[model samples]
Target: MNTGRDEDALRWDGDDDPTLDVGTRTAGADPTPDASGHDAASGEDAPPLALPDGFTAVGKDSDTVGHIEADGTVVMPGDKAPLSSPMLITLGILAGVYLLFTIGWIVGGLRLQGTAQFLVSPVGYQVALWLAVAAPALWFVTAYALTRSSKSWVRIVWLLAGLVVLVPWPFIMVGAVGTVAR
Candidate 1:
């Protein structure tokens, strides 16, 4: 019975190329010597890798790759930190609120369909209803995009403002059941 595990099937073209042997070195081992005859970890006064123009090295062992300006200032590019846990949670909550607002608008607008038809044409009512339904999402996206370059607090403030301004008033008053809440 053949196990159907052919070794030849797992091999790709250029599999024997030495240049493709990345991450194959053991821990604490020096990297292969470059064409300049210098080992990367040999502690010699030579850079490990040549960086392209306008590009700077970052991450582990990046201090050795720091670029020096003519004025003797060392320029090191740092990685942008990810969003904090609290900010992420806050954004998630805001997104949930916006989603709920959109659902509320949809339900509320549909509930008003009968009354709206009497005041406006069927097409006009439908267009208005859809616009209302999309208002929350549009506001959220716009605020997020516009405030991307601003501080986190500014974004939060804009989102909070939208929450206040885009309240589904029709839904709050008439509700999904279509009964006026005193």
Candidate 2:
């Protein structure tokens, strides 16, 4: 008899597939369709399978596990890790570094005001200065999100580069001595 399920249903990508039911075969019924005495055209009834003790049946509530879609993309389990604790710690530290850079801009911008006149008006300069200060954090977040499917090292490299390249120049120049006289 054609059960309507195709042969592809037998292929399991991973554990937790709903189709992977654990049960014994019914008596007088073969797993495969064949021309034996118990043929589909015979219309004979097969006995109910006796389940083992403590064996719970798989129900509709069961989660859909990993599977390869028609497009050939391997979809991972829903419970898979998005990011570990150590990776979170690294990201937290990077966030803190970005915060420190913002503080540096506030302090150094005040000091730099006395040393020179900005090419743009003071108001325009302030807007550009703050955007520059915020750029590193934005870069880190964007790179981390974009590289979710990529290797960890790729994300790490991009963040490290942002940390170095986005250093506040005004903060570094003023140093411990404060802003210099013209």
Candidate 3:
């Protein structure tokens, strides 16, 4: 009469332990009503509960609250909010500007290679040219890193300042893209 399936084998030996039953109350423990006559387990129209340690209430009338971890750290709404659409578009435009600046530096530096060699050694000119080419990318990355914890407007300001300061002057004045011919 034994089938291949063993029902006892499907469960652990401790499955019958009363302590493993989370929903049932212990033998002698009574549910006590707190102030306003609401039992803790019932959760019915409970008064505003006290937030655990390190949790901060946010918004008008505290309608919405942040997640409180067991270790007492709070995860705020803004902490994990993704970039807004306008902010994302602005970042994309700035990134394109930086890329264009890098290209400008390359084009301008190569165009001036022959002229620069007379004033500085070829090795020195090459090093300086490469540094100039890297300036836009370096400024963009450094600004982003330094302003990570600041407001979006602050980051935009820093990036805009870098754009003005790191313009490829030679490219605007003498490169093939410039109005002036060699």
Index of the highest-TM-score prediction = 3
TM-score for all models, in order of appearance: 0.56, 0.52, 0.61
Clashes, model 1: 0
Ranking the candidates on lDDT from highest down gives: 3, 1, 2
Q: Rate the local accuracy (lDDT) of all candidates.
A: 0.77, 0.65, 0.80
* Per-residue C-alpha lDDT of model 3 across residues 65-161, encoded as one tens digit per residue: 4565575565544455457799999999999999999999999899889988999999999999999999999999999999888899999999999
lDDT of predicted model 3: 0.80
User: On TM-score, who's better, 1 or 3?
Assistant: 3
After the best TM-score superposition of candidate 1, give how far the Cα of residue 104 lies from its true spot, in angstroms.
0.5
* Model 2 C-alpha lDDT per residue in residues 1-182, reported as the tens digit of each score: 98746955875557567677555566775554232224343355433222334434366523333444454454434534457678889878887887777777766766676554545677777777778767766887788899887777788788888788878777778854455677
Scanning candidate 2 in windows of ten residues, the lowest lDDT window is 46-55
Q: For candidate 1, what is the lDDT?
A: 0.77
**Which regions in candidate 3 have their CA more than 4 angstroms from the true location?**
1-78, 177-182
lDDT of 2: 0.65
Clashing pairs in 1: none
